[model samples]
Target: MVRISQQRVKCIGCNACVEAAPYRWRMSRKDGKCTLIQAVEKRGMFNILVTDDEYDANVDAAMHCPVNCIKIEQV
Candidate 1:
């Protein structure tokens, strides 16, 4: 399962996640942050759904964030 830590998401409204994983990610206008819309179902646990094809791009977006926020992990 893949997960992104909310604490580390500074979400500059770039919508990179949304573009990369349209089925799973979105931007929350209320909070000006990007959020995962779907949950991964595996090992009796739920994590954010980040597709394999979009993984590297999303990770790059996170790493290149001006605020240095965004956390991606697999468990």
Candidate 2:
């Protein structure tokens, strides 16, 4: 399974994750920070799954995040 950490303290509100993985990431209106609104489910395992085309986009977002808040993990 893949998952993103929910610690909002590290988020810089840069919206990198939102741009990289639009399907997985979203911006919160209250704070303008990027977050995962849904989980990626596959084969009974939950992953931080994004489309193949979104891989680079998401990676780029993670890299560009000023606070380095976005965490992509495999479980």
Q: In model 1, what lDDT does residue 28 have?
A: 80
| lDDT (Cα atoms) of all candidates against the true structure | 0.59, 0.62
Clashes of 2: 4
Candidate 2 Cα RMSD after full superposition onto the native fold (Å):
5.7
Using lDDT as the measure, the top candidate is 2
- Mind giving the per-residue lDDT tens digits that candidate 1 earns over 20-48? 55655677878877665665444533356
The candidate 1 region of ten consecutive residues with least summed lDDT is 1-10
Candidate 1: the clashing residue pairs are 8-70
Candidate 2 lDDT (Cα, 0 to 1): 0.62
- After superposing all C-alphas onto the true structure, candidate 1 shows an RMSD in angstroms of 5.3
